[model samples]
Target: MKTKFKIIIGLLFFSLTTFAQKDQVKILKKIYAKEIITDADLVDYKKNATKYGDVAIEEEDKVYSEFYKSILPILEINALGANVTTMQKANFINMETISDLSSGLNGTLDFEKKTGKKLYTDKINETIRNFKPIFWEYVVVLDGQKKYKEVSQAAYLIYQLDKKDLERLYIAAEYALRAKEYDKSIQYYNELNALKYTGESTTYIAKSKVNDEYNAFSSLAERDIAVKIGTHTDPKIEKTPSRTGSIYKNIVESYIAKNDIPGAKKAIVDARLTNPDDTSLILTEANLYLKTEDFDTYKKLITEVLAKNPNDADLFFNLGVISSKSKDGQAEAEKNYLKAIQIDPKYRNAYINLAVLKLEGETKLLDQMNKLGTSPADSKKYDVLKAKREGLYKSALPYLEKAEELFTGDADIKSTLLNVYNALDMTEKAKALKAKK
Candidate 1:
């Protein structure tokens, strides 16, 4: 009697567990079968679906489910077109999740157009009416896929939706730049500048496990909780610097591209005032002077930078490049180039430029040789010039060889070295280089 009672209790428990599983499945199926034609219907269905167990619809289904819910409101709005407010449109616009609708919406419109059930323009208007959060979310998704033009369009739409959201204009400027809409980018940037917008924000970050680099969290509380829970390490609250300098710098660059030198100069001065200690602003000013052939000012500004950053090899290289542009400045050019090399022994560009400086006289000598007539005097002169040319080749050889050794993968260096080798009749070296090629 005791054994039978125990068996009966075990079977009853098993039957109850099996019945509960079956009931959950039945509830999930019933929820899926209901036609969710309105947002209210969806809300009811979601409540029922989650009542018995935690059930998530497929991601694609969730997207289309939201689309199905929008249909009734969209049709009603079209029927009662004049009665709707922009706020109503904005609300519905933010209701639908349209990210993963790669082809469904367009296909539906095409079908409607073909059947004459709905005009194409009406469908387009409906889409435009319900365009906000769709466009907003798509901007992020499109940016991730590197679809710059689409991102630009979406960002512009968001800007249209809320002109008061200056951050949207900022984002529009960025995507416009990426999409190569330079004029549009400049327009947006200028507007931000007029508004005196300095885009600065504080971010909560912690070091990531994969790269050990700081990854930002959505909020300070989240970051602190993650750190406290030992999920992330190296918690930090970082304040982003202002974008005023960069905004002005971008304006200056666009102006330079347009060859509006005066505009660039004016913007660069403002940029420097915005960030007085920015080294890049100083460089920009120097480059502007270099562009206008004001070498005196270029050298003075560069000297100022070198005084502050005496160990910078690239600064010395810039001085060398500037001096080498003039015939009388070759000596100074060589001295600065050598100084750059002394600071950074592996400076490939300095080596290449030094070789180039040594070879500069070859062109003049060749010109003089070509102009000479084929007389006995010309022949004697030719021999002297030939000897000088050979000496020039010898002078440049060491620097070229060193540059080649340092940057074997550099095509410019390889081409220059090959030409020098052939000119000097370095048969074995030329052959070796050809074999490598």
Candidate 2:
């Protein structure tokens, strides 16, 4: 009967030991395998390394071992990660000597477990503090070269970051890019861009597009790959951070690139905060509106600048360009061009433009002959001026004839001069221009 009682006691002890090990193991495995963790994990991972005040060598060993067992594989991973980072490496290496501590703990635990010693609660607590299994998962996945690892790391990093860390998200993007997970990197980059954290919005968007192009180009090889993927057109991105006084500038550039002149102007108007004393922004705003044929904003902004500075050649030029672009542009275009000439007589474009305008009507080419006055006559010049002043050879022939004096041997001008003669109702001159060649 006594022997039977002792056998029961031994069996009960064995069962208790088995249950204890299994319970701890199950707890960890469940937390790890499911890959879901609680806030407590984050809190513990952030727990201080200097928690035990003046710990003895044996106590420190006990503490390290306990942390290793309870933390699963996360603590060492973080230390390595922190160490690998900028300047964090120097501090991390000198901070606590992680490798030795971890090894000592594991070795001590193995020894203790073999001898059937009681498991300490402090280690479990430390492990609980050292939460962040993604850290370990990252190492494992990277070490094993798992395809999903980089994307997974990026997602976790994004989740872990708060407001202050939006910029650091670039690191996660690097991993995602390296993994060929272009979409995920874009997500992070786009998020950062949206936060207005750094650089121009279009800048980041441009970078993203470059990455997309590289990726698409790498995957395919065809002459029309750009046209095929429509990769030539950049995908739109949300507004991002801006440089001081450059928000509107950036938006304008983005619109130009997208070929949305009207949209670009609208963005400028919407975000139009300009220097108070300077109406340059107003002039810019007007020019953009004029490009879109939005006459109201164009007149309003340009007029405002002109009112401030009447002699403003830029505003006059702006008005001239707008006038010329209008449907009934002839009259207003002539008026603005003259005004520009009056303001800056030496404005080279005004002289050239006036020369052009005279030939548009039934005016003589010699009317504004003084503008092209005396360029040692060349067919190249004649041809260039001829093409530029099309539809009015009556006013252009004299200049062409005069210019042909120097470049009589030039085939291009000689050919154009013949056409000018035909328009000028001078059949004899046309014949003469052709006959010379």
TM-score of each: 0.62, 0.32
lDDT for 348 in candidate 2 is: 50
List clashing residue pairs in candidate 2.
Answer: 44-129, 45-129, 65-105, 66-123, 71-127, 196-241, 365-395
lDDT (C-alpha) at residue 366 in model 1: 92
lDDT of 1 by residue, 1-437 (tens): 99999999999987775575456545544543443334554455455434433322444333333333334334433333456565555443321233222233544454566666663336444565565454565566678889876676566656554456678788878777777777777788898989888888898999866778888999989988888887789988889888876777677777776788988898898878877787767877888888889998999999988888888899899999999997699999999999999999999989989999999889999998888889999999998998899888889999988987888878898888888899889989998977764
The most accurate candidate by lDDT is: 1
* lDDT score for candidate 1 against the true structure: 0.72
Give the worst 10-residue stretch by lDDT in candidate 1: 94-103
* Clash counts for all predictions: 0, 7
Question: Candidate 1: deviation at residue 147, Å?
Answer: 6.4
Worst 10 residues of 2 by lDDT: 47-56
Q: What's the alpha carbon RMSD for model 1? A: 18.9
Error of 2 at 437 (Å): 16
